[model samples]
Target: MIRARHAGVAAGAAVLLLLTACGSHGDNTQSPAPASSTDLTHLQKLVEDAESAASSAESDMARE
Candidate 1:
């Protein structure tokens, strides 16, 4: 009975140690910079151009 209790405690301790080692704390080290106003403007232009081209292609296909 005593040996069984020791084995249980050892197993529990091993599990706790493994869990603590695998946990992640918040990572501020590699966080992305917030997009600047210039970046947003460039992205908006790119998206608009892509959508316009897609619409033109779809319109051309519909005419065919």
Candidate 2:
């Protein structure tokens, strides 16, 4: 029937759109940036502060 043909064509177009949505276009501009020295220093300071806070909490918990 003509209705069935139209339904099939709609379904095919939907599937093709879905496939292209998920397919990679082989673009080289998606690479991640390298972390700078300042970034590393900031992250290291954050970890140190977290560790210091954890140690302080443990000390407080010990007195409870």
Candidate 2's TM-score reads 0.50
Would you list the C-alpha lDDT of every candidate in the order shown?
Answer: 0.53, 0.54
| Cα distance off (Å), candidate 1, residue 11 | 50
- For each candidate in turn, the TM-score is 0.51, 0.50
**Which runs of model 2 end up more than 4 angstroms from their true locations?**
1-31
Error of 2 at 33 (Å): 2.4
**Model 2 residue pairs with clashes:** none
lDDT of 2: 0.54
Candidate 1 lDDT over 1-64, as tens digits, reads: 4344444555555554444444444685354445556755655565565555556666666787
Local error of candidate 2 at residue 31 (angstroms): 5.8
